[model samples]
Target chain A: MHNAHNAKSILHKISRAFLILIAFTATFTAMILSPMLSVNVNAYTEKKVYDYGDLLTDREESRIEEQLRKASENCGHDIIVYTVKSLGGNSVSEYSQRAADGINTDSDGSGILYLVSINDREYDIYAFGEMYERIMSDRELNRLADDLRSYLSEGDYYGAFSEFGKRVEKAALNNEDYSGNISVRLTLSFSTLIVSAFIALIIVFCMKQGMKTTRPEITAGNYVKNGSFKVTVSRDVYLYTSVSRVRIQSNNNGHRSGGGHHSGGRSSGGHHSGGHRSGGHSRGRF
Target chain B: MTTSFKCACCGADLRYSPGSGSLKCEYCGTEFEAEAVEAMAEAAESDAAGENINWQHANPQTMENDGSTCTYSCSSCGAQITGDRTLAASFCPYCGNTVVMSDRLEGMLRPDYIIPFKVEKDAAVAKFKEFCKGKPLLPSGFLSSGRIDSVEGLYVPYWLFDAGVKGRVRFRAERVHTRREGDYNVTRTQHFMLYREGVMDFEHVPVDGTSKLGAEVTEAVEPFDMHGAAPFAKAYLSGFLADRYDVPQETCRPRADERIRQSITSALANTCRGYTGVRPQQQFISVANGKIAYALLPMWLMTVNYNGKSYTFAMNGQTGKFVGELPISWAKFWGFFAGITAALTVILTLLMNYFG
Candidate 1:
């Protein structure tokens, strides 16, 4: 009877050890698989390319998406490219705004979106947040659109999107914007210091010259007798006439209002009912 | 020969008093009218002539001139004073007594008119201080280091010219008209050939007559009011240094003509108005009825030494107009420049950030 009882106790201890091994294996497998699952989710969510129009192949879309992702990382702003088959009942501007509003990534909403509508043959660029206030203006958006219009007209959609990515990246890196409305990073560069020093030297030189009060008198104005000047024969004869004409320059460049439809009803941080986002856009037929 | 004026009361040396028109004794404080002093000297000369006494023997200070230089004995201290032929009056360095070289002022060298000093030495020193007051860049030690004893009264000779100028001036002038026509700016310029002829007279244009003084230095203190001028007398030379005309009259004629030409040309140019631009094409000026006279003008001169350099200052004795070049302090200049530059840089940066 004692031998039988010891055999039962050993058997119970073996089963408990087997169950613990099973639980450890299951928890370790879950820990490894969960990260892969989250990575897949983040990869989809972080995608900057939304090609619903079937303009690019899967491979081309992936390549452009990777390019835009790197560029966004570099410029600290999300850059997006969205293509749609139809705008439904909305204008290109509203469609683009909806596309921007649908972005659910974890980035701060300081970004720009390039939208293309295949059926409507229209394209638009929308900016929000810091990117809007710093570098995006109506003129700059139009300039970017004009630069990519040729590729779009040629039906090289892949090339157009790729060039768009490159140009946006370059512009973001340079922080270039429309003239007369852009903030400049103030720096006391060597050239600025040199020019300032030169100007200062000239001012001080003039001040030093003022110390010299003596100069040779070349005119005798003080010695001229008053009331003694006379002009006996004064004649003004017409000799010839010459005429010149110059065309006046038009000063209307870069002051044009955007041709795109604008809605002051989207917040920079999130979509709202009627609050206007501080941003700008440009739209045109491709 | 040097002649030192003596006080009639105490026999002490008499010096010419500014704005008083008289000689005042340094010891007795007695003043004698300049005209009365001249009358007494003339009466003495006549009495010596009546007695048939040699004037040089009676006045032992008189001596013969040796070519371009003259030596005279000071009546007050008996020190021998030597100077160039142009030196009409000077002070004896050892005795600090004034001596007038009477022989140098004889004959053709005599000045026709003299403007007596109206600004005294003390007033001139005050004017110097005033002149240096407003200058910010002047060296800090310049005014403090300047000595008052270096200031001296001087009678500078000048050649006064009166001339009637007849001139003809031709100018190429233009009248420009600008009009806007349909996105174009149309400019029409009317060219004209202008001729102006004039006759004018200039009175009493004084030119510096001493070669020792530069034209710039002498011309700076100008227009000694001829109204204050009196007939030149030897009494005016007492206690003051005088310079005879070292620059010849012929040598100064070109300067007078140049000045007259400039005046006439400017006068003719003034008549041409209502033109956008006028440039002189040709000018022909002829000076007529030119008259020249010699005069002695008063100037207060001082030399200040600073930083091992001497700077000369001069004041118009009649008008008290002082002129001099002041030294610049580099420390102050650089500090001001840096401050202005920093201020402007900050302002420009703020403006760019706000507007750009």
Candidate 2:
């Protein structure tokens, strides 16, 4: 009976060890196959570049596709170029954010989207997730927009997209050298003028007030009519209400804003100055 | 002619002490009510009214050999005093005594109201000293060279005008409201037409008319408590000198009118309330009728010649409000400008570098 009990205990220990081995093998196998499954799904589904506006010719599309794919792979970021014939009654911002959500289905929202609305003549650079904050400074972005959009305006679509890819990649990688650029100089000069003017006014006012002994009362608030303030004629006529709109040119294409009522389309390209400043200093170190 | 107020309790001399709002004996520190002193005196109150302005022509003076042109003696110290046409006994420069040289002043034009000195000479000196303290650019010698010793109290002549006015004012005002609709921020500004018509009664708007006193000094010393003015008494002039009006009432009337017109227009414009901005488009003020009275307001005036430049400073003998022009140092101004500008710019640059 003692021999039989010891044998039974040993068999039970062997079975437990074999079960542990099987569980480990199954986890390892799933880990190995999961990435392959996602890659295959993404290969068939995810779009790297989009030419919805149909502005690019087939050869131009292929070239842009090649540049964007390299930039995206090199930076570990989903860099994309999307164009649409119209915003489809949606703001460029809404469309771009949606496009970013669609294109980055398999990844975290860490990428930049260059979206163009052809008929609106507007283009926006929208950065998502952590990479959004790491993008170039607004001043630097202004410089970029001001510099590269000339090619876009002249209809050199390939040249413009190509230049945009290189510069955006250069900034995202924190390798830009703006120390010799005129943007930095313009910033310092303009800041000095504005700050100097304000300080000069304060000093001038203090000196003037110091020298001046008397300022006659501006208003006879002392002798205001009885009962403080009384308005017997309280009529605010509904004089026809007119609405005026200003078409903002967010792309820096030298398009002057015209006064007219607009449809529901608003450009989502707000100022990127606050984030761009950090991007610029990152630029400085490199 | 010189007049003096003596303290009833101490039998010592009394001068109008500004801070106490009474005639105060400097030696015994006893205060006496100004109106009480005026009433106890023998001369009866003559109901001095605004219509009591009497104009006179002046006689030309000859320069004296001793540099004492017009002879006016200090009644208390027996010192010889001389000044221009408005010359009254200032303190005896030698004895440091307050003496009112009261001759030919009352006969020319008796002031209907006197806002006696509510601020003392020491207070005026203190105010002047305070004004000189912060001005590092001022020539050091200007303060140490007894420049402030020239400050003295005098009753400046002003004509008080009372009037009932009819004011009609028109204003253009705007009210703006903004709303966000889809992509557009719609701003609607409503323009308004406002009119105000009313009657306002203004009392005791004093306009200085003394030829010896500049408008610069007098206006700076303004806003005396006209309500505190006791009826003018010669007894109040006992230890203090008063300036007789050198400019006629008619000449001063235009200034008073201008002041009242501005005041009424502002008052009426303010009555059109509840607008983002209200601007006076048109104003019409008509004085239904006005009354004018000659009065004396207190002021301490000093004009110092420092570095061959005259710098004028005045203190309100009623309110201790000090006003003066100080010498400017361009070097100091630029030094501060450079330092502050550089400091602020550095801070701004660092902030922009971090989060521009």
- What does candidate 1's lDDT look like per residue over A1-286, in tens digits? 7557545654564465455545543553354334333311211237899999989999999999999998887766778999999888788877787677678333345678989989989998887655666666567778989988888889998998899888877876677442222222323323344566678778888888767655566656676677887788887665445689999999877767765333432333435433344567788898
* Best candidate according to lDDT: 1
Model 2 chain A worst lDDT run, 10 consecutive residues = A277-286
Minimal lDDT window, size 10, model 1 chain A? A178-187
Name every residue pair that clashes in candidate 1. Answer: none
Q: Superposing all C-alpha atoms, what RMSD in Å does each candidate have to the true structure?
A: 28.5, 29.4
TM-score, model 1 to reference: 0.54
Off by over 4 Å in 1: A1-128, A131-183, A187-206, A245-275, A278-286, B1-108, B180-184, B305-310, B347-356
The lDDT per prediction is 0.67, 0.58
Model 2 chain B weakest 10-residue run by lDDT: B42-51
True interface contacts reproduced, per candidate:
0.62, 0.16
